[model samples]
Target: MLSLTDVDKVYLTENEAVQAVSSINLTVENGEFVSFIGPSGCGKTTVLSLIAGLFNPTSGKILMDNKEITGPTEKTGYMLQEDYLFPWLTIQKNIELGLIITNLYNEQTKKDAMTLLSDLGLDDKANAFPSELSGGMRQRAALVRMLAPKPSLLLLDEPFSALDYQTKLKLEDLVFSTLKQQNKTAILVTHDLSEAIAMSDRIFLFSSRPGTIYRVFDVPAEFKDKLPLEVRNDPNFHLFFQTVWKELEKVENQNSNTS
Candidate 1:
């Protein structure tokens, strides 16, 4: 339901201009999970911000459904690396914060928020403050807060990177299942090759700074219906990883040659 065409972003300083993203064209179909993977400073997050209208592009346009996105649209929800929960507010209150800000407060909104919290297994923790919850719980709460608004699109920026490996794996499954259940269209920015392959229906591999789509691949069958662990165990998993790794290497090598 989201489309970006020939998008470009440039950051200017006194001495030089840094092109963070270049000619990025992408389309996310309804209910599709698409992940953008690249090395650090490759503008993955920049792409997310552009889609969210946190910043306008230097060139080209972004559209959701058919309307051009001018600024942050209510039809989209964003989750970042940090949970960013208010320390003082309880889980329930935190989730309610979005509803209140959007003026969506009402009986139905509250009921939906509570139902989301319960589904994420945070029903009892609803009364607990952010300080009292574990990292995973906090992340789950953060996601609940974002999804409670029922936005048409979800933007996730390394949402699982802060957790330990085991927790990350579990949360990946949790997030994957949750999104599938909610039937939400999502675009995820991540550096982890395995994580991207495990959760995404399609993966976009981006080049380094002045990021552009270097390659795109449809995830294999092993990952289509299986858990993250199962996907990792598949023999072709390493092959796919190596393939993406080499594509990234080519970008670095080409940049070096030009420099």
Candidate 2:
């Protein structure tokens, strides 16, 4: 339920102006999981910041549920690559932080937080500090904190990049199941093609700097119902990966030639 129309973001410097994103238009429907994929410096994270209302676009508009996003809204939740848990806070308190910030804490909030931790298989670690948990557990705990506030829209910026391959796969399933059960609208920025295909209903491919939508792919049927690992084994998985890889190569070549 988020839409961006003809969005552009430009940054000013002492010598010149840098355009990070240009003429980017995108729509994410309710209950849909969308992922943006591109090479480094493609402005994918810029788009997420704009959607989160962390900053205003230089031009165009971003709408959430038909209303313009003026500034950071409570209706949006953001999870970053790092868990960013307060080292001093226990897992239960970390989740509670969201509720506390929103001025919504109560006995029911505590109950819900515990239930979410349990669902994510972090129940045993609820009393553990961030320093005591593994990377994957910390990420899960961060996600639980983000979702605890029950925001309608979730923005994830490469939330799994730090984990090992096996942990990443398991976390992907955990995130997928959690989002489905909650019916949250999600937009994730990821470098992993397989992760995007396995997790997103639609994948948006972006060009390099001054990024714009280069291509959009609706993942094939084989991947539509499989786990991230299972999707890797699908015959067409390699085909999809090759296609996107080539598209990214084209951008690299174009940038090199222009430079």
Candidate 3:
């Protein structure tokens, strides 16, 4: 569980302070999957960094469970647009990176890593270096590395952005299913409206730079049984997409006029 109360983030330099996020209030339930979708430089990723305690908010507070998040903790796992896997490392070693960091590696930790790769259909490639893997495979390996720590929360920052459309869809399905199976809470920051709709139980729309919470949309249950790609063809999908698109456009236009 996580809560952000009127959170604001400002970056200070020698010259001036730049506000990146403003007036954000949000609560994500345990085991929930949420996404933030908005225009570029709108602070979606900044908000995520706040949650991970990568950056402290300039004002207000971010709480995990009942306590404030001061800095990075084992409770969170972060996956970025770049896989960030070390090319020299084999897939298995890369997957073990998280465990090794926490000094929690053991027979069982090794076993868990092995079983996770096996379940993800990457068992045979465990000995292969990152350079030997395809883009999708490397990303999958990255996900496995993040999941290895057994974090209660997962922060996804455009995790599939660099992949081809077909590969992106497959990874979306895999990641969603894996998160559900692992019962991990997630907050995703994505530019893609459909990706947000297909993956999130709730979607938060943010405004332009110095981002503010523009609106929040709850994904309908009609497509609950469908995967991301399958949900795409569902009639409700297009309808909901249109509604979300309008809200985004409206906010963008408002931002444009004021600027």
Candidate 4:
């Protein structure tokens, strides 16, 4: 449903232009969950911003649902490192933020927010403020808010990094299932190789800064049907993890030597 062709991004300072990504060509199929894994300073997040139309690309193009992306569209939902919940607003109101922004807010939209909270077991906390809930609950509430608008594509940017390990793992399943149930396409950018391996149908490995596609690995057929935790516990988990880890190490080392 989304594709990037020969994409490149550059940032200009007073002195010189810095290239962030180079020739990033990618395609994410409808309802597919894809993850981008790379070292720090790589252009993974840049690619997401391009897809989200947060800014224009320096070269090449990004297409969504067969249309070229020009600017941010309501069909995409973004979840970042922090929940970004409004402390003054109740969870229910926060969940409806997208609807309100789109001028789509109405009684049914409010009910839909509540329904999402209820389904996610956050209904009990719907009336609570952000400061009143634990981090995990707040993040779950954030997910409800992101999903409230029924976006077709979800862009996740290391969203679980601040959470504890158990909570992170739990939310992984929650997010994976939620997207599947809603039939939403997703693109995740993460430094966590294991997280990417466990959650993605396919993982896109990127090179160091001025990032380009290094390799695209499809999860083994046997593990494709498994959930995150199940995949994590499987024997091949180590193998997949180690393979990516070694690849990342190689990328880093090669860059270091060249630089």
Tens digits of lDDT, candidate 2, 1-259: 7899999999889999999999999899999888999878889999999999999999999999899998976699999999999999999999999999977789997798899999888899999999999999999999989988889999999999989989999999888888888889999999988889878888998887678888888877667656667777778888988877788788778777876
lDDT of 3 at 141: 92
lDDT of each: 0.88, 0.89, 0.91, 0.88
Better of 1 and 4 by TM-score: 4
Question: lDDT per residue, candidate 4, 1-259, as tens digits?
Answer: 8999999999899999989899999999999999998878778999999998899999998999899999987889899898999999999889888788867688987788788888888878988999999988999899888887778999999999989999999999888888888888999999888889888899998886688889888888777667888889999899878877888888878778868
- Quote the positional error of residue 89 for candidate 3 in Å: 1.3
The runs of at least 3 residues in candidate 4 whose Cα sits more than 4 Å from the true structure, single-residue gaps closed, are: none
lDDT of 4: 0.88
Residue runs of model 2 more than 4 Å from their true location after superposition: none
TM-score of 3: 0.97
| C-alpha RMSD of each candidate structure in angstroms | 1.5, 1.4, 1.1, 1.1
lDDT of candidate 1 vs native?
0.88
lDDT of 1 by residue, 1-259 (tens): 8889999999999999999999999899999899998767778899999999898999999989899998886689999897999998998999999888777878998999999899889999999999999999999999999987888899999999999999899999899888888889999998888898888889998877678888888887667777667788888889988877788788778767756
Question: How many clashes in each structure?
Answer: 0, 0, 0, 0
Residue 167 Cα positional deviation in candidate 3, in Å, after optimal superposition? 0.3
| Deviation from truth (RMSD, Å), model 4 | 1.1
**Reference-based TM-score of each model:** 0.95, 0.95, 0.97, 0.97
Model 4 — TM-score against the truth? 0.97
